[model samples]
Target: MNRQIERWRTWVWVLPAVVLLVVFVYYPIVDNIRLSFFSWSAFSTSPAFVGLDNYTTAATDPVFWHSLWNNVLYAVISLIFQVGLALVLAAVLEEVVHQRLRGILRTIYFIPATISITVAGILFSFVYNPQIGLLNRALGAVGLGSLAQDWLGNPQTAIFGVIGMSQWQSIGYTAVLFVVAIQRIPRELYEAAKVDGAGHVRTFLSVTIPLLREMTTLVVILTMSGAFLVFNEIMVMTAGGPSNSSQVLNTWLYHNAFLTDDMGYASAIGTVIFVITFSISAAQILITRRRRVQW
Candidate 1:
């Protein structure tokens, strides 16, 4: 009787969350699938079914392809700069930095992360302004006025500019994660490495990175997901700009569903995005497992 009562209590506690998931999460997912099979709710007087036409259209859309390629590029670039730089920063902070300075540095690094992505986008818009932007000012100061071309306005450099801001915003967050992982390493191992005359580089190669393999894998997976989901920055800064050069999957989906009132097509795009992100995350886990160094 007592165990039954306890189990009932546990279930009662879980009821709210379960109900919320069914309503907010599961329901929307089912509704999205249903909407995707028909024209948008806004467009149709009675939710007219269009079968596979939406999928067919999205599959052949050039904009969709461009957005996909752009997302891939963004993911790759963000991983390299964000996670790679974070690892380096973690290493430096762990070994060389003093305690107070480390805290200050972390705060400074994380400031960009605390701000809204949209705000960051707007701020960068000013910085990338062709006429009086800070970048052009800096270039002119260095007697490189010829090089001060339009950044966000130019299709060639706009995506790259977004990538830079995204990377900068992400680096500190990744660094903090790495710092947490690095701190978990046993001091005894580090001491043993020191006794063995293993210097900083050797200790890092042998002890630090190998110990944080799981964390590295986690960071890679999360960063890839976030990069693929990028919307606000592109939306605020370039709005898929100078000729759709900065368009990503999320932005493309938004334009389809909200702008074009094509819910079915957007659903197909969303589903595709979900599949790609899941596949990449799975691949990261598998690769990490294969490569994880055993201590």
Candidate 2:
């Protein structure tokens, strides 16, 4: 009887969190999925049941496919720069740099990540501006004037410009995470590598990389999922402009929801985003679990 009462007391403590999740998170997701199956807009009083029409529309939409492709491109670039290169940078900072200098460099690298995404986006916009922008001016100063062009104005370069800004802002944050992971590694392992006559490059490949498997998995998952869900920077930078060339999934969803007032279609896009991110996360976790490091 006493144990039952104690269990009930524990349930009482857990109830608030459970209720909050159901009300705020789970309920909204369910409602959004429900909305995806109905034809509704901001002005609609009566939402008509549309079955799979919205999903079908998204499937057939060329812009939707393009947006998805942009997200894939974003994911690939983020994985390379944010996760892969960040790991190498983190290794260099943690293993090679003096302790005091490492701190300063880490702070310098992470400053961009501390800035607001909107601010960074706007700042990069100026940097990419054609006529008087820093990038073009630098190119001209270096006698590479022919290479200077409108970055965000041209569809060919707009997405890449946004991606470059994202990488610059994010790479340091990921590197810091790797730095922490690298710090957690036992120093004895490095000493062992040294005793075995392993050079820096060999030590990194044999010792650092293997131990970092878990952190690498986590960073990759985060970078990929975040790429698919990107919105603010793209919105502030290009607004998917110069002919819808830079439209990512979230921005496109926002465009349909608020701008076009097509709430149902927006919900459908939201569903797609959820499905994609969930799948990516799940697949990563599953694959990583199989190869997780053993003590």
Candidate 3:
């Protein structure tokens, strides 16, 4: 009797969450897919079933291709600077830094992560401004004015500038995660490596990296997803640009759906993005699992 009552009590708590998921998550997903296949507008009385028309149109758009290509480039560059640097820093901090400094430095690195992306975007925007921006002024002060130009507002450099800012805001969190992963590595292994007369580089390559495979996989997954979903910085820094050079999928979708009121077309783009994100995530899992060694 008591077990039956406990199960019922547990279900009572779970039921509300289940209901909410069906209402918000599942229902919206189904509806969005449906919207993707049909032509509808904000003012429409009825949706016209158009099969893959929306998808075809979106696929053919020059702007769509540009946004996707830019997003890919951004993800690749960020993966290098963001994930690569974070992993190295994490390894160094874990192996060398004293405990007290480790704690303080973790806090310092993670501070930007706690700040709102909007605020950081705005701050970077001002710093990159041409006429009176700090970056240009500093360059000019150091007699590098010839190298300085409009950073955020310029077509040639705006996307890279926004990507640079996003990377700066992101690396802190990546480093903290890496630091935690490296710390959890057993001390016994390092001691064993020392007995073998392994140098720092060899130990790291053989001991630290092999152990940190999972964390590295995690960093790749998180950063890849975040890179694909980039919107806020583009909105704040370039609004997709002096042209559309900085536009990403999310921003382009927003432009079509909300700004242009092409709801069906945007939904189509959303579906494509969803598919691409899923494929990448699946590939990451497969690659990571294949490389994983059972310890």
Candidate 4:
């Protein structure tokens, strides 16, 4: 009887979290899946059973494909600039022997990350403005005026311009995560590398990089997911404009749901995003786990 009471108390502690998850997470997901199978507008009183018509429509939509491709581009760029560059920056900071200098530099780098995304987006919009923006002015001052164009207005460069802003905002945040991981490594390993006459480059490549595998995997998953789910930057910067060139999946879904009033279609897009992110994250975890087991 005492054991039964103890078990009940333990469950009582866990019950609130379970209830919250069911209500907020699981319920929304299940509802989205149900909604994706119907035809409904936000104004509709009753949803009609559509039987995968929304999915079919999405498959045939050119703008959907474009948005999906832009998301892929975003992920690729983030993997390179956000994750890879942050790793390099973190390694450089870790090598700095002066603690004060390292701390100052780290703080400087991380400042952009603490700013609100909406604010950052608005700030970059002005920075990329054609006539009076800082970027074009600097380019013109440096005699590179020929290279300056409408960064956010040109269809070819719009997505990349938005991505550049995102990188500036997020790279420091990713670097901080790497810094924590680097600090956890045993100092004896660094000593051993030094005793072997390993130079700074060699030490970083051989010692630091090898020990950071788990952290790298984590950063990659986070950056990739964020890339795909990007909405605010696009919304504030270009509104996925200049002919829908910068439209991403999330923005496209927003357009469908709010502007077009196609909630069912929007739900279908959301479901697809869920599936893509989940599958990629699951595959990453499995692969990372297997590698860890092998090591």
Candidate 5:
């Protein structure tokens, strides 16, 4: 009787969360998957089951492919700038002897992350403006005027400009995560490294980098997922303009669903994104589990 009561208590505590997840998360996901197989515009009275036609349309769309490639590029850039640079910044900050200075610098770096993405996009758009932008003016002042072109207007540079702004916003957040991970490292290991005459670079490469493997994996997953879902900045700054050169998967999905009124195709894109992200997450879990067992 007591065990039954205890089990009932457990269910009572867990049931609300389960209900919420089913209603908000699982139901929507299942509905989206169902909708992907149907043909429906926003104006349609009812959805018509079209089988794999929506998926076929998405697969053959050249703009979808372009947007997908752009997302891949964003992921690569995020991995390099957000993860790599954050690691370096975290290492430097961790080694700083002055606590006050370190705290100030970290706060400064992280300030940009707290700003709204819409604001950042608008601010960067101004910075990238050709005629009166700070970037062009600075370059001209430094006798590097030739390097300054239409940053957001040009097809070649538009995506990269967006990427640079994203990195500026996110690198600090990534660095903070790395800093926390670095703080958890055992002090004895650092002392031992010092006793063994391992200099800063050698110690970082050997002790720090090796210990940070799990954190790096976490950051990669987060940064890559964010890259795949990037939309606001592109929407605000470029709207996937200049012939869709800066288009990403999320932006393209938005364009199709709302602007073009192709809800079925948008659902298909959403399904594809879910699959890709889910597979990556599952792979990461498996790899982490294996590594844990090996360790």
Candidate 6:
């Protein structure tokens, strides 16, 4: 009887967390999915069911497609810089740099990540301004003054400018994560590699990269998911402007929801975001599990 009562006590302890998840997380998601099937607005007391209409409209919307393409571009760029280059940078810091200098450099690189996204966006805005901006001044000094243009004000460069800022803000933080993973690697492996006549490049490819697979998977997923959901930086810096060239799905959804009061369409956009993130994450998990190497 006492053992059964103890088991019941465990369930009692778990109940609150389960309840919170249902109430705050699961319920909202379910309600949003339900809302996507209706024609609704903030002012609507009764949202009329318009099954699949919002999705149909999304399919025909050119702006929706453009925003999706921007998200795809962001994810690809983030994976390259945040995961690929960050890993290489982390490896160099851990293996080549002097210990004292490594700490200082790591701190310096990570400083931008510690700043609020709004602040970073605002700062980059000034940095990319065509006239009197640091980038333009540096270009002019280098005899490339012809390249200077209003970055955020040009449709051609607006998305790229936002993407560049995102990479600059996030690359260091991703590298720091890689550094932590590198530290956890067994030193014996490196010693063995050295004894086998392996140089830094060879050792990194054969030992460090393979062993850090788990962390790589995690970082890749995080970077890509964040790229797809990007909002604050774009909102602060471009407001999806320069003729919506920098519009990402999240920002587009916000514009539809609050700005235009197209609640149902916004819900559909939210659903699309959820589906894309979930599918990509699931695919990554499956692939990682299949190839996971044990240390």
Per-residue lDDT, model 3, residue 224, is 88
The TM-score measured for candidate 2 stands at: 0.96
Clashes of 1: 0
In Å, residue 199's CA in model 3 sits off its true spot by: 2.3
User: RMSD for each model, in Å, please?
Assistant: 2.2, 1.4, 2.1, 1.1, 1.2, 1.4
lDDT scores in order: 0.87, 0.95, 0.88, 0.94, 0.92, 0.94
93-148 per-residue lDDT for model 4 (tens digits):
98855777998999999999999989999999999999999999999999999999
In candidate 1, stretches whose alpha carbon ends up further than 4 angstroms from where it belongs are: 285-295
* Ranking 1 against 2 by TM-score, winner: 2
Q: Where does candidate 3 stray beyond 4 Å?
A: 1-13, 293-295
TM-score pick, better of 3 and 5: 5
TM-score of 5: 0.97
Q: Give Cα distance to truth, residue 218, candidate 6, Å.
A: 0.6
TM-score of each: 0.92, 0.96, 0.92, 0.97, 0.97, 0.97
Please give, for residues 1-295, the per-residue lDDT of candidate 6 as tens digits. Answer: 9999999999999999999999998898889999999999999999999999999999999999999999999999999999999999999999999998999999988998999999999999999988868889999999999999998999999999999999999999999999999999999999999999999999999999998988999998999899899999999999999898999999999999999999999999999999999888999999988775422
Tens digit of per-residue lDDT, candidate 3, span 195-280 = 99998888989999888888888889888888888898899878998788889999999999888988999998888777787788
Residue clash pairs of candidate 3: none
In angstroms, give how far residue 139 of model 4 lies from its true place. 1.0
Question: What would you estimate as the lDDT of candidate 3?
Answer: 0.88
Per-candidate clashes come to 0, 0, 0, 0, 0, 0
lDDT of 2 by residue, 237-277 (tens): 99998799999999999999999999999999999999999
